[model samples]
Every structure is written in C-alpha cells, then in structure tokens.
Target: MDGKTLVRRTNFTRIIAACAFIFATAASAGPTVKTLRVDVLYWSMNIPGQVAMRKGLEQEAAAINRDADKKNQPRIELTPYIAGDGSAGIERQIAQMFEAVKRKPDIIIVQPTDNAALAAPLRAANQAGIPVVAYDQYISGGTLAAFVTSDNYQAGYLDGEYLAAHFPDSKELKLILVEYPHVSSTVERANGLLDALRDYRQPFRILKTYEAVEPNSGARAGAQMLRDFPATGSVDAVFSVNDGGGLNIVEALANAGRTEIVVASIDGDPKSVDNIRAKRLTHIDAAQFCGPLGAEAMKIAYALATGKKVAPHHLVPVFPITSETLQLYPGWGGPIPPRFAKPWQARVPYWEGTVRPAK
Candidate 1:
C-alpha cells in the first residue's frame, strides 16, 4: 500500500478508538449513589398500606436498587418498625423514631399517634437535617417533609351523605358511631361524618358512640349497643370508621336478627366488598389508593435523602362505593388489577382497577 493511504487508514482507526473510549467513559459515569434508610411505623402488616409495601408497590427501594444496578444512584435500605395498636403503641413508635434519628436515617415514615405525640421528634429530625414523611395519619402543623394519606375527612363525609340519602324519610334517625382508640384516621372520619350530618336538621339522635380497642372489637361494641338500645327500636344506620369495624357491626347486627339496619364504613376490603355484595353492608368510602400512598411516601423519602425539596403534605383522593357497585372487577381483595393478571403494572392499573368496577 502507498504511505499516504496507510497514514489515512491509521488516522481513521485512531479516531474510531478515541470515540469508543469516550462513549465507554460516558456510559460508565452514571447517576450518583445515595444511601437512605426508611422506617415504617404502622399498626398491622395485614392492613392495606402495610400490605402494599410488603407487596412492593411503593418501589422507592426498588427504584434505588435499579438505579444502583445501572450505575446511576446509591442503594436505599428500608427498615420497618411495627407498633402493635392504640395510643401507647404509637408512643412507642415515637421513641423508636428518636432512636432512629441518632443513626441518622435520611428519612423516616411515621403514623403519628395524634397531632402532638411526634411533633417534637419530627422537629428535632428536621433541625438535624433529616426529613420526616408521615403516612396514613399526619402530625399537623409541623415541619413534616411530606404527609402522604387519603382525604380521610371526605371519606367520612361521603359515608354520612350515603346514610342520609338512604334514610331520607326517617323522622328520627338513630345511629351508632363505632371507632377505634388512637386511630387518627378513624377519629378524623368520625368527626367528618358528624360534621356532614349537622346539615340534616332532622330529629336525629346519636344514641351512643363506642370505642373498640382492636379492629375486631367493633362486633362486641355493636352487640352491646344493640342490647342497650333494643327497646328504642331499630337503628337506622351504623357508621363504622373502618371496614374491619364495619364488618364487625354487620356481624353483630346479623347475630342479633337486626339485618335491616344499614351498615356503612370506610376502606373497601375484600370482606367489606363481600358484605356489600350480600346486602349486609350498605356503603363504603373506598380508599383504594393505599399503594399510591406507599409509593408517595417512598418518593418523598428518596427526595429528602437526595437533598431534594419536597412538599409538606400530599392528600390523595378517596371515593365512595355502595351496594350497587362493588363487584365489577376481580381481585379487589388481592393486589394488582385484573387487567395485569399475572404481574402488577403501575398507577394506571391501580386507578383503572379501582374505577372500572365502580363505573
């Protein structure tokens, strides 16, 4: 070959090699690594939020792990600390969060006992540059990095509206409000229902209100209420703040041969949906977005860990489900919508699944 041709070929090969090297370097230089720790404070793993986390809907940790695999980000490790139930247990959760703060977790997930219990610790965490994200129930008026939850008050108001619509002609409406102690969600819901009912202006009497120590305690409370007010005639409606509690009320009413009483509650779980199908339960203020709530919680945690700005609160919407519409879709009891079938998709599937049946 001629010397000039050889030189030109060598230059071309060198240029190709340099380009490949630059491309390789750029590919290797991916996103930065960020280490974040998350703690989940909740009553039971069996509930919807915990269940979503367990089922992997939040995907914060998973997203971090994926980014790590792609050489783009750091690994996020989540540690869950479960508090059994009620005010005392939630107090213990606050103690655990204080201890976690010392370890310096980038973010912590809390279900506050009330508006006050976790205020100090959260403030301390914020002052120390750690972000706090609360879920299910929020600790209001604090430096909470983000509050992820459904519109609980609206859910309760919807329940009240449903009851009012169902019993429009009643002159004197007798009802029982069943709730659980230290459950901020329940408290807000019950209060919202009472607030909505105030517009009725009828001779409605709240015969009594009862507190259930556990979710299942609603049955006992309902039965006792029935026995106590049997002579006063039948209850027009029973408003339970949660599905489990509502189911308990239904069971109690059934056992007492008072199936005619309308039952309503929030959270459309499998049993509650079944009860609706069977005509035992009348209404449910459904918050089928627990998965999204978990996802939002993790997203806020990730943002805080990475030193990104996040909102102080996030209010997810809630919907009402009645006996007329509860079973249009499958796996309202299981995770993932019916469309995905084998594996779960993203928020689209969740919204579609929850809304399709209702529509």
Candidate 2:
C-alpha cells in the first residue's frame, strides 16, 4: 500500500476504535439503580387512612416495583409506622421523620394533625432535600413535594345538605356534633358542617359538642348528649365527623331509646351501612378516604424518590351514600353518583365493606 493510503486508513481505523470505545462506555453506564425508602406515618391501624394505606397503596407500590424491575432499575422499600392515636401518631411520625432525615430516606409519607405540627418537620426535610408527601391532612406554609386528600370542606357541606333535605320542614331543631380533638380532617369536617348550618334561618341550635378520643368514646359522648339535651325538647340531628363517631352516636341514641333523631356521618363502612340498613343512621357521605389517598400518596412518594415532578396538591373527591341508594347496592356502599368523574367513581368498589381485597 502507498504511504499516503496507509496513513488515511490508519486515521479511519483510529476514529472507528474511538467511536466503539465511547459506545461501550455509554452502554456500561446505563441508568443508575436508585435505592428508594418510603416511610408512612399514620394515625392508627383501623382508621380509613390506614385502611387505604394497607389495602390500596401496596398495589401502587407493586406497580412501581414492576416498572423498575423491567428497566433493571432500583427497587423501592416501603416501611409503615402506625402511631395508633391522633396526637401520639403525629408525635411519633415527627420523631420518625427526624430519625429518617438522619438515615436519609428518599421519601416520607406524613399525615399531620394540623398546620403547625406539619410545617416544622416538613421545612426541615425540605432544607435537607428529602421529598415529603403530605396526605389525609393539609400542611400549611411548608414545601411539601405533594399533597393528597379529599375535599374535606365539601364532605362536610354535603353532610349539611343531606341533613337539610332530610328535615326540610323541621323547626326548633337541636343538633349535636361529636368530634375528635386534634385531627385535621375531623376539624375541617366539623367546621364545614357548622358553617353550612349557620346560614339557616330556622330555629336550629347546636345543643352540644362532645370530643371523643376513640370511636366508641364518641358514641358514649353522643349518648350522654342525647340524654342530657332532650330533657326539655328534642335533638333533630347528630352530625359526626366520621362513620365511627356517627355509628357511636347512633348507638348512643338507640341505647337511650331516642331513635327518632337523624344520624349522619362520614365514611361508608359496613357498620354504617348496616346502620343505614336498619334505619339507625340516616345519611353517610363517604369520601374515597382511605385507599385512593393511600395509593396516590405512595405514587407521589415514588415520584419524589425517583426525582420526578408531581402536582403540588391532589384532591380526592367524595360522595354521599344515602338510604335510597344503599337499598339498591345491598351489602356495600352505594354506587357513585353519575355526575362524578373517573377515579372518584372508581373508588366505590374499594369501600364496599370494612374488609376489602388488599391493593
């Protein structure tokens, strides 16, 4: 071969070798397998939030796991810490987050009781660059990567509307509100009911408000209220923040032999459905409270862990489960009203009973 030709061929070979070398390096450096750890802090094992987490979130996490596995990507490890009571749960969760910050968990799922408790730790996590998703309750003035919950105010307003429709012609109505002390969802629901009822010009009075720590406690408190109030007149309605409280109120009324009062509560658990069936509780406005919120929060957690962008807030919608509809869908909560959209309507199947197939 001529020297000139040899030199040209040598240059071409070098270029080809360099290109091959670059390609090999790029292929070797495929997407890094990220190790994600998620910590879920919840109020109790039996509540709707925890129920959702237990039933729905596992499915979402499993889907994420499947996707990651297909791409030969890092797996996500989810760890849940249940605090059992509202106040204690919040404190324990805060402590867990502080410990997690040190351990550097990729994601933390938190349900704070109120704005103040939520802000501090969330801010600290944000400053440390750990992404946090707040669910079941809203946390104000904090850099939460995402927030997922039902429109609590709307749930409460619907409770009021149900009561209004149930007792349109009633005058001199006496009402009782059974509540939990420091739960953000409960507080929001209570406020919504009171605010909606405030506009009524009828002779309605909030006869009493009782705070109960446990579900049955609300019922006991409600019974006490019933016995104490009607000595002079009658209680037209009892509004409970949740089904547990509402069911308790119904039990209280039944025990007191004052079954005439209309009982309405949130959550469409089987017990509440049974109450509606037996003509004990009049109305139930159940949100996709547990499963969807739990599942979506985990989705947000996975996104944050993988450094993906997510919406700042996600509102899970709720609907009313009345007596008429309950009769149609026996053995579970009634069908979602036709006016609602997807996902919200999809939740009707999940909350048919107290025990559902795990997600």
Candidate 3:
C-alpha cells in the first residue's frame, strides 16, 4: 500500500480503539450512588412504643447502609423531627409535615397524632410526588404509600377474649372501658374489644367509657373512673385501650381498694408484663411487635422510594400475655420473642396499593 493509505488505516484503528476505551469506562462505572433524603416525623417521643419504633428505624437505616456498602449500593440519610410536646404535638407535626414538603424529601415516615388531622398535609405531600409511610398510628384520610402497625383489632379481640374466659361464670359482667378516640389504632382497638365482648355468649354492661386520650391522661381518667364507680358497685373488669392507660387504671383501682377488678389492655409494655408476673390487677396485655413494626416500615419505604414493589398495608403481629404467658413474651419494644410461641400463628401478609394517585 501507499504511505497515504497506510496513514488512513492507522487513523481508523486509533478511532476504533478510542470508542472501545469509552465503552469499557461506561460499562465498569456501574450504577450511580444515589442519596435518598428521608424525613422521620414522630407525634411524641414520650410514647414508649413510638420511642422503640424510632430506635428500630434508626437501627434499620444503619443496617441498610452497612449492607449497601458491602454490596456496592446507595446509602440513606435520615432527618428526624419530633413534635415539641404531647399537649401541642399534633399541630407541631402538621407544621413539620408542611416543612418537610417544602424541603422536598424523597420519602416520609410518620406516626400521626390524629387520624384525620394530618390528612391535608399528607395529601399535599402525596400531590407533590413524595411518598408517605404511616407508622404506629394509621392516618385515616391521607394517601400512604404503605402503613405499618400491629394488628390492633386482633390485639383487642384477644384481650377481650381473655377477659371473657376469665369471667365465664358471671351472669352479668360490668366493665369499664378506657379509650382514646382520636387515633385510628386506638379506635380499632376499642371497637375490637367491644365487638369481642358482644360476641361473648354471656351478658355484660359497659359501666362507663372514659376518654383517656393516652397514657399521659391515664391517671386522671383512672381516678375519675374509680370515683364514678364505688368499690361496692358491680364492677367486674376494666378493658383499657393500651397498657399505659391500663397501668393508671390499675393504680387507681389499687388506691381505691378495688383490687377485685381485673384489667385487660393492649401494648406489651415491660412494666405491665412485670405487673402480671407479680400478680397485679392487670391481667392481660396485647403485646405488639413495636420494633419490628418500625423496621418493617423502613424496609417498605426504602423499596417504595427505589421504585421496587411494596405492600400498601403491612400489619405487624401481636399476641396476648398474662401471668401464665408473661414469661413467654419478649415485650412490645422489640422483635418477636425467639423462643416464645406465637399465639396467632399466621401473618396478615402485605397487600398492594399506591399511597394515593394524583387527582
């Protein structure tokens, strides 16, 4: 070949080599390291279940990062915000939700203070293309990418069933109900308890229903309940919505010398379980898998933000704990007990649904 033709062939080879170099660089680059901003908003840090849940979520995030590092994947950055105090916590949470939207976070995990109160802000967040995960308390009116909570209805049913079995011989069982109506979980729990009682073959009467909003208000409500129903009255048992309220109710009963009254409630709080082990007035507590609830929510949120398939609703399992079963439970603040036999042996399973599609 001529010198000019040789030069042309050399230049063509160089061009092909350059293209190959570009292709190799692109192929070896792998996926881009993505940064996901997650806002974790809680109604109140004072709530034991919420506190445990928050801890679980933090641990989950750390675990996710560690695993991602090992597998050469992206990491998550969480921004946590707590409502100032319980008294005005709901309003503060709403404000925080709006602020989070302004900051444009990729996802939000929240434990709503009220079922309907947080709806508007959460709906707005959905409209802005941000996914929201409801943890602990269910938001009745918002669009949630996923909801993670214990089977509150089942817990209440179990508590009521225990009460029925204990008082089977009584012809007319008089019971006091302590409930918090604002929260969806509490509402479901209350309804479940009542329904279980209704389904009981024996006759019963609801002596009174005191609105003990939460554990914080338990003392006052418990005290009032004691005053309203004298020890000489026909009060057989008390079904409180949660362990917090149940503890206060038990205290009031003790103070009023009304130790004969049996108490059943939700939340497998450690203190409450200890009371059972010690043979206190509180008989049964529905133990929630609190930490697992949070951890599960975190996992679902991560899948959702990453465009992976996730269940729209996730129900953590719960079981009943009494004096006989206290030793078998691991309490509500952690995962299911390794050695304890699960009473309700089936999982609710995850269901598919979008948080809320755009209008």
Candidate 4:
C-alpha cells in the first residue's frame, strides 16, 4: 500500500476509537440528582394535631429521600414556617405565605389559618406556576394541586350522634356550643354535630354558641355556659368543636360540679381519651389521623414533582374514641386506622377525595 493511504487508514481507525470512547463515557454517566425545595406554612404550632402533622411530614420526607434511588427520583428539602401561637396567628400566616411566594419554592404545603384570607396569595402562586398542597384546613380562594384533611363533618356527626344516644328520652335536648368558625374544618364539625342531632330525630335547641377552639377561650366559654344555664336541668349537653378547647371546657364544668351536662368533642387527644376512661364530661371524641394527614400531603407533593398524576383532593378518615373503641387507636403518629365497628364506618375511603375539573 502507498504511505499516504496507510496514514489515512490509521487516522480513520483513531477516529473510530475516539467515537467508541465518547459513547462509553456517556453510557456510564447516570441520571442527574435533583433536589426539590419545599416550603411548609402552617397557622399554629401550639395544637397537638398540628405538631404531630409536621412531625409526620418530616418523617415521610426523610423516608422519601433515603428510600428513593438517587438516580431515579429527587431528594426533598423541607422548610417550615409557623404562625404565632394565638388567635392572631392567622395574620402571621398571611405574611408568611407572601414570603413563601416570593422565595419561589418547588412546592408549598400549607395548613391555612383563615379560610378566606389566603385566596389572593395562593392565586398569585398559581399564576407563577407553583403548586400547593393543603391539609387540615381549606384555604378558600385559590386552586390547589391537592388537599388532605380529616373527614371533619363526619367527626362532628359522630360526636353529635353519641350525645343524642345518651339523651334518648328527652323530647328537646338543650345544648351549648364551644365553636370556632374561622376555619372550614371547625365549621364543618359544628354543622355535622347539629345535623346528626337533627337526623337522629332528636330535636335540640342551641341554647348558646360561644366562640373558642383552644384552652383559654374554651375555659371562658365553659364558665359562661355554667352561669347562663345555672339551673340543673337548663342545659342537657354541650358539643365542643375540638378537644383542644373541649378538654378545658370539660375540666371547668367538672370542677364547677356540673357533671350533669354531658360533653362531646373532636380530636382524639390523649387527655380527652383519658377523660372518657375516667368517665369525665367528654364521652365521645372524634380522632383524626393527624400524622397520616401530613404524610399524605407530602406524598402528593412528591408525586407532582416527579411528573406523576395525583388526585386534586385527599380525605383521611377520623376515628371515634369512646371508652368502647379506645383500644383501636394508634395515636397521632401512625397511619389511619382501618374500618372497624359499625355506625362509625368511613364516610369516604381514605384515598377517595377527588375534585372534578371545570366544565
């Protein structure tokens, strides 16, 4: 062969070898590791259910980061902001959400403080292409990627049903309410309780409605209720929207030696359950799977981040803890309890919340 031809062939061989080397390098390089920064904004930290929920989010996020293969999915970085611990906490939550929007996180998971206040900021986030997951409470005006919360209405209904069953013989049961109407969950509970009483064919007069869903206000409400209905047979029962305030109200009533007024409340708080066991004023408490609610919110966010389709709403079932059903409860950190016992069965499946698309 000619020398020039031999040199051309050698150069061609070198080019082929270079192409093979490039291909091998590209093949060995794995998928990029991604990080999803999540901003979690909640109304208050003083509540047990809220605290348990945040813990659940952290736990589930950690598990997602560790269990997921790095090459396949993204790691989660959670940033949490809590509103101040008082009635004025809603104002702080509004400010924090504005800040969260400014920061432009991959996602925002929030438990709204005031139902209608977040409408504007949430809409702003949507306009900016950021997705949101809401749990425990509904924020009124904005479109959400997903929402997860306890079946609050059913919880209240169950509490009301329990109260109605106890006072079966009375033609008209007189009840007072310890309620906070600021958020959808609490409001739903109040409505549920009233509806249950109505459905049971047990007529009731809402003798008084006092506003409070926490300890201090609850105690005040309880004290006032006692004074208002000073007579022994004036008030037959009281329904508290949550155990946070309900428990305190019961203490006040019990201390005042007003044991005749039976109480029904929501939130499967340990103290409330103990009250039931000790036969205190709290006869039936509707328990939320608080931890699972938070975990479900995180799981929904993760699904959205990874391009997986998810339902727009998720509803977790609540458990009713009377002294009879207390043994089935696994407390705030575990997943929701399965179907057990009649009449207290789920209103909707644990995974069955769906918000239909607009026409």
Local distance difference test, each candidate? 0.65, 0.67, 0.78, 0.82
- Model 1 stretches with alpha carbons more than 4 Å out: 1-32, 46-50, 53-60, 140-142, 181-183, 200-203, 328-359
Ranking by TM-score: 4, 3, 2, 1
Write the residue-wise lDDT of candidate 2 on 1-359 in tens digits. 99999999999999999999999998998866776888776656656435655566777788889988888876888887666665666777677667766777888887765556667778888888888888877776668788787666667866775565455545666787777746567787888776656544335678788876457676578767866875533677878777655666677677767767777777666777777777764555554446666777787788777768877777665656666565434222222333422122221223222312112
Error of 4 at 214 (Å): 1.7
lDDT-superior candidate, 1 or 3: 3
The runs of at least 3 residues in candidate 2 whose Cα sits more than 4 Å from the true structure, single-residue gaps closed, are: 1-29, 198-203, 230-233, 327-359
User: Candidate 3 overall Cα lDDT vs. reference?
Assistant: 0.78
Model 4: which ten-residue window has the lowest total lDDT? 349-358
Per-model TM-score, in order, reads 0.77, 0.78, 0.85, 0.87
Cα deviation of 23 in candidate 2 (Å)?
Answer: 12
Q: Give the least accurate 10-residue stretch of model 3, judged by summed lDDT.
A: 350-359
Off by over 4 Å in 3: 1-31, 84-87, 337-359
Question: Which candidate wins on TM-score?
Answer: 4
Q: How does residue 202 of candidate 1 score in lDDT? A: 34
Segments in model 4 whose C-alpha atoms lie over 4 Å from true places: 1-29, 69-71, 343-359
Q: Over the stretch 1-359, how does candidate 3's per-residue lDDT look in tens digits?
A: 99999999999999999999988998898767888899989776666767788888888899998998888776899999998545488888889999998899999999888888789988899889999998878786768888888888877877776776677645688988888888889988988887776776647888888877456588888778867877565698888888766777777787787878888888877877877887788888887877777888898888888899876777777767877666566665554644443343223222211122212
